[model samples]
Target: MIKYIDSYDFFACQLDNQRCRLLALPWEDVLVAHILPRLPLMQLFDLQRVSKRFRALIRLFFTKRTTFELVGHHVPKVAFFSLVKDNNVLRKLLLESCSSWLTDNDLLPVVSRNPRLQTLDLSGCNGLTRHALVAVSLTCVHLRHLAVARCDFVDGPSLRSLADHCGELRSLDLSGCCRLTDATICYLAKKCVRLTFLSLAVNENITDESVEDVAKNCRGLEHLDLTCCLRVRDVSIRTVAEYCPKLQSLKVKHCHHVTESSLEPLRKRKVLIDVHPPPRRDRLSLAVDCGPYVNIQPLSARLLPSGLNADPLRAHMNGPAKVSDPWKNHPSFPPVMPHLQSPSHLLTLHPSCLVLALRCSSSPSLWSL
Candidate 1:
């Protein structure tokens, strides 16, 4: 019984010694090296709530690697607010579709902290305005890839500020920014010489002049989207094909004036061009004038009765209603005799009558007769 008691006490002592050794070890180092890095972003945020020590470790992790992405529609606002509330080492921040909880105020505080941000994507964040973009441009001078697509409040001045500050910008997407004009694009083209990918889709005010400027200045451009830009014409396309040699993909969908002939040069260069079909003209407008014979039956309609008992030479001078399939029925004997009983009947008709029928069917207006 005494040996059993001694064994129990010995086991308890070993357990206590193990606990002491673990407590003596640097848990913060363990967390920073192993456990924290494995945890996902949400779990890391949750760890910050555990204690001041874990929060400090998270801050250390942020300092070590400045790239942070807070995307998703349901990401709690508090998560972001807490992240940027006190820290400022973030370099790449992407906040997409978080507009519900992410307001301009929340974003400004974060932006003010991360002055070295390189890649920022606030796409679909409608709450952002020109002021926010300007702040980003002025503060984040190293920005390279900026996407503020669908941010309606961004205008020429905001873009100019961004171009002026972030001259190294390589990719920019301002799609659906209705207020942008040629001036904004021209400024960007002049400043952002390294731009490779640009999307200015749905900016109706941008004309061929801006595209020409882009072709001239942004020689490094590879992909460009000018979809729904109605003012762009063949001249701009030809200019781009001639100048932007590195151009690879070009989107001119819904630009009615761009013709297939103008895009042939780009095709020769192996550029991927996306062009929508030209708007179709009205069929009635394309109809040829039939002159006085406009009342003549269409070529598709039966010009005479087709039966063994039917008169071969009798011409039917019926109106459009009497014409049987205007599309499929052809005038039996070329409009000459108006009616011919057979091939031998052509010799019997007067030469004038034959001439009149031929003229009627061959008339430009009666081309469809």
Candidate 2:
């Protein structure tokens, strides 16, 4: 029994020596390839707190990844700033809806550090100013996509700075930037020739001239939004159709002057166009005269005699009729009639009455005249 115990102790010592050799093996050579790729981003970030070796490995992993995103509301501001200040290899950074704590100073350090940034999205960052945008444009010369929508502080000078510096810019969103005008758009059109997607929705100051400038310069444009650009007319639509052959999608909602006729060219090219009808007031005014609704009585007792309707064209044959004429008392007749000799006379008639006049000339029996 004593000889058996000695043999068992010697076996246990050999097992302990094997365990020590396994633990002493180099983890960088064995574990990095097998473990790092499978780890979650949070886990990788936590690894940075383990030791200097771990921190170096995680930093190398992030540098190779080259993209980072942080939300201002969820992540602590100090942590985010520290990450931006530390990471030098990030190529894209998205700080969306970050108005809660993001400021110009925080943004300045980020752009200043990451001069290689190619895409930066600061959408809804209302706390940002013109200085931040100018700083980014100056620092990140390779920036291709930028979105500053709803940043009310962005104005003409900021856009001009971007146009001058970031010539490789491909996509830009200035939606809800109410201060933008034709001058700013013209500056962008002339400078950013590589722009492919642009949104200027809700900017009331843009006109056909700015659109024409874009058409003349930005040949590679694929998508455009001019929603609520009240000054934009059909001429701008025609200009885009004629020039931008690659245009795939266009939004012109609330652009009152853009009629269906003007959009035919774009449709023929298979471009997707989003257009909404004119307001109720304009539609009603064009189709019928609803203005005299208060004066309209029920037709039961208001109809003119058959004899009076029999010679409806007789009133037009003579020049302008007096207000005291028999037909003048008829509800169907307008309150006033101009001489019906020129084409302009048709303009004075209600649309319904105009159709009635035309029908009377072709077949008076249709109305039982």
Candidate 3:
């Protein structure tokens, strides 16, 4: 009996050595991650092939390694936190750990194991909609910088959850989250009052009402990017001017409604056009007026009904309109202002004339593209 036991012990010792060698491989990061989890399930199925002591050591290392991975970075470190599919085994593990990291309401799991995590970059994690943000805000309380530019799941429930829970949030980048609307803006304003830097680029749903709410709540806001927010008319900028007193840098490109007057609030507006915006006295709708140099006929022609614009055109059939009527058969009309016929013709002179207009209504000093 003693001889048999010794033989078994020697075989177990050799098995432990082989398993350790696999774990020690340093050539691939991917290999370590793959093998770590399997150690648990592998022991349950194939431990007999290796010594009992070797199996116990592998399980111990697996637990320790996972804990290390979770708490590894805390400084300016960046990480990707995403939800796995329902069928994924890891997803089941994550779900089981769902204990509220920040709130008392839900027993959701908070990912606060890392004290040094600063930048939580979830740029393209499609599965992690608003449902997951609440937990993050609670767990990552030290998180000052966050980028969720394309996640669309952040609707009302999760957004409001953040404001109520994560009041420390400062900078947020929601550049391409198109589904977010006025309600989300209001929640952020009312909850996360510390938001200093924000980017709403290409968010098609945000309008003047949303801007007003943000201005009211986030008074400390400094830098704002309103690029591609098409509905942001003069009203939106006007609100920002009245509310966001500390604003410094702004991007209003493609905001056609922006005008020199709209820019009266900002100290320095970043305009991406070569030509200097027209004077305030000649300001258009909010920022684009047809005065300082804009032609009169095209302005009235399109803004006015075709019936009215046709009146002067039809009237000329009797005899003539005037030398200034560029469309008439006047002698000097074509050479003087060659492209001065229809509103479309005037717009051909300057493409910025589409129903779209943008301006830096934040304030005004020097403007550039």
Query: How do the residues 1-369 of candidate 2 rate in per-residue lDDT, one tens digit apiece?
Result: 112222323422435656653223355554454545565445555656655655766655554555766544465575575455567877988888466778898889878978999988888888888899999999999999998888888899999999999999999998999998899999999999999999999988899999999988998999999999999998888888888889999999889888987887787788888864334443222222222222212233124456555244444445454334555566654454332232233434322133223222222122111
TM-score for candidate 2, residues paired by index: 0.63
Candidate 3, superposed: residue stretches over 4 Å from native: 1-110, 267-369
lDDT (Cα, tens digit) per residue for candidate 3, span 1-369: 112223334434434646654334542354335444543332323443466554554444433342222222231111112211111111112221121131222212324344334555555546454656777666666667777676676666776776776677788888888878888887788888898988888888888888888888899988788888888888778788778777876787887767667775464554233225564544322223332223233233465323334455444444444523424343322223333233333432321111112333444322111
Clashing residue pair totals per candidate (backbone < 3 A): 13, 0, 27
Q: Relative to the true structure, how large is the alpha-carbon lDDT of every model?
A: 0.71, 0.72, 0.54
Better of 2 and 3 by lDDT: 2
Q: Which order, best to worst by TM-score?
A: 1, 2, 3
Model 3 lDDT-worst window of ten = 83-92
Q: Model 1: how far is 238 from its true place, Å?
A: 1.3
TM-score of each: 0.64, 0.63, 0.46
Against the true structure, what is every candidate's RMSD? 12.5, 12.9, 17.5
Query: For residues 1-369, could you state the per-residue lDDT of candidate 1 as single tens digits?
Result: 111222223322435546553223355576455554565676566556655655676777755556667665367776666666666777788888576666778888888878888899888888777889999898889989998888888888999999999999999998998888898889889999999999989888989999999989998899999999999999998998888899999999999888888987788788998864346645322244554343333232243335422222223222223433322344453433333232233323221222233344555553222
